[model samples]
Target: MDYVIEAPLVCVCDLDGTLLRSDATLSGFARDGLNRLINAGVHVTVASGRSLQAMRALLNGVELGLPVIGLNGALISELDTGRHLLIRALESTPARAAVAILAAHGASPLITSWDGTQDRVHHVKTMNAASDWWVAEKREYGDPRLRLSEDLEGVAGQEDVVLITGFVPDQAAERLLEQLRAELAGAAIIHAGQHIYCTGWTEFQIQHPQADKGHAVPHLLELTGLRGSTVLACGDHLNDLGMFAAADESIAPANAHASVLAAATATAASNDEDGVIHWLLRRARLIGAS
Candidate 1:
């Protein structure tokens, strides 16, 4: 059932650990509720660390009414049309430094970039079990972005460096995070923590300094012509902090990271319980009531 909701509003939701369950699947309840929101004239969109291609795959059946924030804000694109609304990349100098640093640790980091067209992920042969598994999974999806490179460093040093990512052993990931933070201080935005899918491994991602969800949300609002709309942002991770700061209201799932929960304006049920969709429905009800 659809009800009239006359408010000019927009909702920006994070994918992993918020909209999706622990197993990375969107529940039927959540999927239906999302469509209900769209039917009610709510401008709904997503902000995710996933690439545009991956996001499209994950949200295959959903109708996205606005451009999605992808690659942790390095990209904002229309999922249906595959049109880039905004794209940001790291400087070649710092990008090279990052590639060298990760390679020294024997991490064959995958460099993601765009050539004014489709996204490309460049990598050398896997150097470890974790990276090998990651590559295999990408292959399982038949991800078109995978670009095997003879010289990973050379690829990273080129123009349009969107993201540099790799997986390392748990303890080494922590150490490397600290080292990269210190060495590349302010030159890049570095995120390192437990890899969502790969057990016992830490995933690290390096992106341009300005490429973050917080910086991208405002641009999204303006581009969609919803700049004055009441914006509600939701997430369940540290990367969502910038987005939280930029939003009029912030929400988190019950299972969200401690930091994210503390920063949230409100809390909803765990992702497993379809927290995001529940929260959206409840909010719509309240708006309709008023």
Candidate 2:
């Protein structure tokens, strides 16, 4: 006997190194392809490590109104309003502890929070030169949530922080990861990527245990009334694993990280080659999107 599935299909995509090219911009082919997908009754949206504001900034002119997953799944919200569909925040105690650990080791971590209505980011304790460069870069993009402080003291008092990120030399990042694992047991410690900051070879992000793309994507599917339907998720990094885990079909660019490539159901072209667009068009055709 054969089974027939009735739920609608939804396509969830990652931003960096997946949909967006190496320069952090979307290609014309991708934009047109996604717009066409949306027009064909296929739900299209972004699930990114970027904050809500950053997402809008980077995706400018794309003409999309769907919800987005932000801050590595700490936030799921409307792209325009930043209203949270589902949120998981790091408690004040842990947020402070995370800050303390990074500060003690001369690492100035960037703190992010989603308090339902808006997204806020806090940076504390005398930033290093590289940290300053990162701040300047984001400022050029009109990042409004970036709050600078002399120290972590009295920032967002009593309010929960959702994500904490830091950058350090590859070796130091490794050590920090070990230290964080031991100090912040049960906390999500992720070595996000490498060569991200001007002075560092690795970037690490810490978040609430439930702040994961896997959980967030499923929640979105449920909200869209597509529960149990075939979900096509795409990405090129470890942060994308959560979404991959929740997807029935997962796609990774040819240049994806080793781990991601291994887990992907199939490989698409490299982002520079517009592999995501190719996959989407092919998928839409297969599903008879006309």
In the range 32-54, model 1's lDDT, one tens digit per residue, is: 77877887888889999988878
- Best-fitting candidate, measured by lDDT? 1
Cα TM-score per model: 0.95, 0.90
Judge candidate 2 against the unseen true structure and give its global Cα lDDT, from 0 to 1.
0.77
Clashes of 2: 1
Model 2: worst 10 consecutive residues (lDDT sum): 1-10
Query: Alpha carbon lDDT of residue 186, candidate 1?
Result: 90
What would the per-residue lDDT of candidate 2 be over residues 1-290, giving only the tens digit for each residue? 11222345688899989998887789987887777777666777889888888888877766665688888888888888767887888766667787777776666787777544566777864676656666777899988888766556345345567778767666677677778888878755454568532534566678888888988988887776777777899999998987898998999999899999999999999999989778877776634222
Clashing pairs in 2: 214-242
Full-model lDDT for every candidate: 0.86, 0.77
Worst 10 residues of 1 by lDDT: 281-290
Backbone collision tally, model 1: 0
